[model samples]
Target: MAELVRRAGLPVSAEEAFAWHERPGAVERLLPPSAGIQVAQCSGTIRDGDRVKLQVSFGGVKVPWVLEYYGYEPGRRFCERQIEGVFARWSHERRFEPDGPDACFLEDRIDFQMPGLWPIRSWAERRILRGLEKTLRYRHDTVAADLAEHARWRDRPRLRIAVTGSSGLIGSALVPFLTTGGHSVQRLVRGRSGEHEGHVVWDPETGQLQADRLQPLDAVIHLAGENLAAGRWTAERKERIRASRVEATRRLCQSLARLLRPPRVLVVASAIGYYGDRGDELLDETSRPGRGFLADLCRDWEAASRPARSAGIRVVVARFGLVLSPRGGSLAKMLTPFRFGLGGRLGGGGQFWSWISLDDVLGALLHAIMTDELEGPVNFVAPEPVTNAQFTRTLARVLRRPAVLPVPAWALRIALGEMAREMVLPSARVVPRKLEQTGYPFRHRKLEWPLRHLLGRQTPE
Candidate 1:
């Protein structure tokens, strides 16, 4: 058996630090994006007999691994052992030790063995150890950073929030995050068909919602909208996009405005696409909207929230950049081609791409929720924005693949039409001025670190 251990200091009580791990989305948040692994099913808690099944795909091969929780200590220690997986044996113990009154140390110990020939086993063990080192290090940094962020609101009272788009990617992640942070999450669903605990049915299209259900909400995070990248920008597709964002938002805001005790804050989702096709122009919240279908859509979309703002509720329109994650979004689509060494720069590769890690996006949203001073437009992006070529080269480097081919602008225009021009090739050097001014610290400021963490890529010490 091989044993490995790692430790990190967190600025929170041992109990609080451990509780963060026990939360619903902790595992998903900790799992490295580029690792080609995903939680297929989970019992949703870290208790004895609870199980988590993970699927790992690499080079076209899919492997399923199952872990069963055994040791269960509320705040000090817990253990999980492999019930079914690739290894001959695998067990991991996590311990939280009090370092100080307001701080704690988190430790991870792993014991594992390979089920192969002796010679091959030795080599495999070394590789596994290296991989574990990277993975655990990432987990440590992520948890520590998250705990630190949470520390800022340590004394704040828990809030009850109503969130739309609860099933979408950001919403799914955000709901668990809020719940884990001691907030009550009430999901606003479109229909009563899928109703469950904490779900309130509403119809955005008809502007119908049970006003009583939304009473006493501290905030409302609106994320429901038709996906802009679902298809080519046909006239019909554009209409769906516009209606989904503009009309839905207008209706939701109108309803919220009429509430006797409306939520103190309304965080509506917008896109950096608002500043459309500006070549090399540095954009902040104050930057004027550009021209194009997306820009026009964003203008109307953001305008839809005026009712709630006019009603004295603080409205924050989060203009998001390219959100990077392995599970979905633009990054996921590019991973396969890059891994196959067919990755290349798109449309001259000079367009500046303002990007943000999925975690950072969530952080910015939470910050917006907590910080009253953050009103109007806030750019949810990392401090450093990279050009398309720089992003491509960095990704390829992390994947250890060649990225030499450059897709011509004409080819992209031919293939994807307006989308290729406006969405893919447009330049938006956006900066998170408001978030920074409000003292929101980004967990992932650069592309390389996040890319390495997600992909399980090793960096030389």
Candidate 2:
């Protein structure tokens, strides 16, 4: 059998830190996205007798693993024993001890042995153990960061929040963050055929919503919209994009405004598209909107939420930048080619790509919802905006691949049509001026940190 132990000191009490792990979404949060660990089924939340079944992917092949909780000392320790899995034996323990009035020591230990012959078993064990190191390190960092972020807002009352686009990249992450941090989440999905509009609570097609059902909520984060880069932007596809954001948001806001006791705050997702191609100008919330289709769509989309703003709700228009994550979006699409050293800049490589980590996107969203100082057109981006060429090089460096090829602007325009011109190939040097001024602690400020984190790559010398 092999044994491993890791330890860390947290700014929060042992009880407080332990409570974080026991929360609803804590387990999922700890499962690093890059590791490809998915919870198949869960019976309870880290309690004795609770069982969890997981499918851990190994080079696209999923291996089933099952574990049952055993030792459960409240605010102190818990243990999980492998019932059926890849290993011959597996046992994991989480130990937390108080250091001082406001500090805690955390210890994680694992014992396991591979179930095969000597040489093969040793090789597999070595590889798995290395992965375990990275996974645990990520968990520790995430726990510390989350605890700090939550502690800052501990004084604020836990909120009951509703989220649209809960399945989308940002919304999916945001939900887990909110739930684990003690906020209640109510997912507002699109309406289905034959289902009553009131039951669904949102059907932007005909502007129908169950206004009465939204009462007594503390916040609403509206993130529903069509994918801009899902395909070439034909005239029809462009209209779909416009209607999804502009029309749906307008209708959703109208419904929220009609609620008897509407949520105190509403966050509507916009994009850096609000400030179209502004080659090298550094922009902030104070910057004016740019010209073109995306800019116009963004302008109308934000305006569509007028009913909620006019009805006394504190409205936060979040203009998101290029969100970096390995799970989905543009980054996911680029990974394969980049890994093969086929990755290159999209256009002239001079266009700015104001990017933010998926982690920071979640952080900024939570900050926006909690901070009263942030209301209108908050830029959710990193401090530094990298040009397309810079991003290409950085990604290549992270992947240990050389990026020498470049996709010409003309080729992109020929292939993607108007989308190449506006969405994909525009330059917007957007900075999170408002977020910084309001003290929104960014988890990542540079291009490399998040790329490395999301990709599970090691930090360089």
Candidate 3:
């Protein structure tokens, strides 16, 4: 049998650390996002006593395993051991210590042997251990980042920030960002009461957020709305989409208005679709709303925040562009077809696609929050805009594929109904002039670089 150990330092109280250590789903959230573990079932009353049963997937194969928690304690320590698993043997321990009067530290030590007792040789085992160590280092860094964010929140004036659509694509990413940034984040979950991790229960359909929930606050970032490009925009579907954003915004803004201590700032989510299909036209924050379902919905969505503004809250409307993420989003989805040598330019490749990396979008939102000068409409798009053809070429090049096919406009229109013609074919050459003018620097400024980075093609030297 072979052995390895990894550890992390966390800035938290032994008690607070214990709570997290004991909390259900805590370890699952902390598990590396890249780990392909299926049926990750954790059960038992104790953190160290819980058995974790999972099938680890590697190289198109699944290895089943079971672990048992052996050591148990409330705040200081806990440990786990492999009962029966693919590993020859495995053991881990968690230790919490007081770093200072206000700061605490957590250490994680894991020792394991992989691909158990075969002719797999010592060299391969060492290499695998090295890789495992690298992954553990990443987990430690992530934990440190989380701890630092929580520290910032503890040090700042407590602000109650309630968020809607907290489980959606943007929300899922943004909530973690906000919480780690030291601001108290409460999700407006559907049905339930009393805040947990600053989460508040609110039914957008029913217009219900416990009035007291919004009483204390510093700012509001309204990102709740139906996804525009999820499905075909039938007239009935369009109504549901439009009503979801408008009604939810109206209800939340009204609720904030009723609060004794309303948030000082209201940063609401809008979309670049407000510009519609203005062929070859450059649109900034001041562009007029175009004529379309999305255009009308965005216009109304921003207007829904008026009640909060009228109630003396500083309001900023974020007219967002296409937000790209590595795990999910249009870019990731497009990678599949391109990787298989099937990706091609869409609809003559003439339409302009103005987009922002999800990182930049979140950064811009945080910038808007910190910078009091930012108000009114802010375009959350990258500084550079690329044509559809350029996008196709860049993506294909990144995947080492040939972009020889240009999907006809009629074909797309037939497949996607009005959506293809409107969403996929429109050209809004948007620029983040306002954000740039405010001294906000984009981490990802170009399409090719971000795409490459997202696709894991740009290896480190």
Global Cα lDDT for candidate 1: 0.88
Mind giving the per-residue lDDT tens digits that candidate 2 earns over 1-461? 78889998898999899988887778778888888888888764999999999998879899999999989999999999999888999999999999998999999999989998999988988888898888888888888988899899988899988888888999878877888898888777665523522123578777777555554789999999999889988789889999999999998888888888889999999999999989999999989999999899999999998999999999999999999988888899889999999999988899999999988888888888899878989998999999999999999999999888889999989998988899778999999999999998888888987888788788776
lDDT of 1 by residue, 1-461 (tens): 89999888888999999889887778877787656788889888999999999998868698999999989989999999999989999999999999988899999999999998999998999999998898898888878877787778988988889999988778877886777676788888877734466788779889898776654889999999998887799999998889989999999999988888889999999999999988888899999999999999999999999999999999999999999888778898899899999999998899999999888887788899999888999899999999999999999999999998878899989988999888999999999998888899888898998887777788646
**Candidate 3 C-alpha lDDT tens digits along 1-461:** 56666555666666665665565444543554445655456672355457878788878798877878767877788888888776666887777787766556677676766663456646667876775665566555555654544453364564556677767767776765665444567677776655354567677776777766544777778887787778898989988887889988888888888877788888899989889988888888887889877788889988988998899888889998878765565675676688888889888788888999765776687778767789998999999989999989988887789988777889989989888877888888998989999988676888876665445454334
Clashing pairs for predicted structure model 3, backbone only: 48-69, 149-180, 153-182, 186-198
lDDT of each: 0.88, 0.88, 0.74
Comparing candidate 2 with candidate 3, which one achieves the higher TM-score? 2
Off by over 4 Å in 2: 191-200, 211-215
Off by over 4 Å in 1: 53-64, 114-127, 193-195, 210-215
lDDT of prediction 2: 0.88
Per-prediction TM-score: 0.92, 0.95, 0.76
Tell me model 3's lDDT, rounded to 2 decimals.
0.74
Clash pairs (backbone) in predicted model 2: none
CA lDDT of 325 in candidate 2?
Answer: 83
Candidate 1 minimal-lDDT segment of 10 residues: 190-199
